[model samples]
Target: MVITDVNEYRLELARKMGVTRAVNVAKENLNDVMAELGMTEGFDVGLEMSGAPPAFRTMLDTMNHGGRIAMLGIPPSDMSIDWTKVIFKGLFIKGIYGREMFENLVQDGGADSVWPRSLADHYPSFLYR
Candidate 1:
């Protein structure tokens, strides 16, 4: 899997974690990297965790038709994007507010995992009902 980050340290960490490719966005162009990797069709899947409008826009621009995106980061304010890209590309963007309760997690047996339990216990009023 390819991972992109502005921080060199984080890119290094991703490399250590065995990502197929790790890019430092501060120094290199993402599209150039994609072209070098022979990804002429663009990315098939994208996880948007930065919450930056530019990053999100780049993700939208660099996605292939029928690409799936999971947006987990919460933007600080309102932003705009090219709706034509979404319409013409037929991109599937799912906005994930917070990881409280989700059927997918239960299906994957992650609901019973210690991470969710810890989150629930830490934020009882928000997560635990």
Candidate 2:
């Protein structure tokens, strides 16, 4: 699932990228949607890209046992979270800042040069054209 504020364009993009669901977090009940999707206590991996404290909290709350959360969002300076819940749940909170070596290559060069030739050969035409 891809959570966005209220951008239909982003939702459509997520759908095009094969997301099972694209939820507008601002307009809907995220908790209910998560429950409906059977993501409660079953999701092993969560990528927090919304940068909102509420979104981070929601992701942290729903993580399953031994789950990992990759936080790529940039929260406000005074951001707060439930440390007790995180500690009690034994969740692995990983933070990623900036791109890795491979992603750096993609930034410096085009995907055709950074990715394997075989995979690059199948690059989405729309991305280039």
Candidate 3:
């Protein structure tokens, strides 16, 4: 439920969208926020929408054991991370290419329907509507 962005405007939007915590990683320390929220272990799941390497590294650093991450963004170039973290933490990372959506939409018509409703259900629908 905690979301991080360097952009203040995006963080504001995330707060309005009902995120439990919206952190500007540029100005605030994520560890402090995690401590405040009593997340002594770390996040269980992460969605990497930003292609920034630093953000990806931060996600890796802040995940708990057996954490799951779904990456949608495509990085422009190669980036390195602490492989030990991934190996020892046993984190699961998945690259999400678009093909999976076709299968999902076919298997469950409900998946096809959720996109339009998701804006109203979870996001700031007023902007799009």
Candidate 4:
């Protein structure tokens, strides 16, 4: 997996975490770094952990056709993104909220329960332990 950050030291940390490539956006272009990995076609899945709008856009710009993205970050200020890419690439974007997860877990009566069918199906052990 490729990990991108604004910190060089953070990139080193990513390298230690079994990431195939770590990009320091402070020093390199993400697309250029991705190209160096022989993946000009882009990534299939992107997890937007940072709430920065640019990070979200970066994920969108670096995804391949039929790529999917899940975002945990909600930026303070709205930023414009290239809608053309979303339409042309057929990318799927989703927002994640921890409250919803907790609600589903509680309503479902533990991880073993099946009330929230989608959650249990996608992640059986998310709230199991």
Which model scores highest in lDDT? 3
Model 1 Cα lDDT, one tens digit per residue, 5-121: 898876766666566789888788998999888887989878898998988999999999999888887766778999999999999988884543366557766445423344233
What tens digits encode model 2's per-residue C-alpha lDDT throughout 16-115?
5556678887778766777788764546777787788988888777777778788877899899999987888788887884556347448756344323
* lDDT (Cα, 0-100) at 30 in candidate 1: 91
Regions of candidate 1 where Cα sits further than 4 Å from its true position: 97-129
What does the lDDT read for residue 86 in candidate 2?
Answer: 84
Candidate 4 lDDT over residue span 25-81, tens digit each:
877898787778787598987878788888888888889999988776677765688
lDDT score at residue 22, model 2, on the 0-100 scale: 81
Query: Could you give me the TM-score of model 1 versus the true structure?
Result: 0.74
Q: Model 3 shows how many backbone clashes? A: 0
Q: Which order, best to worst by TM-score?
A: 3, 1, 4, 2
Candidate 3: residue pairs that collide: none
- Superposed on all Cα atoms, the candidates' RMSDs to the truth, in angstroms, are 5.5, 7.6, 5.7, 9.0
Q: lDDT by residue for model 3 over 26-73, one digit each (tens)?
A: 899999999999988989888798989999999999999999888877
Clashes of 2: 0
Of candidate 3, the 10-residue stretch with the lowest lDDT total is 110-119
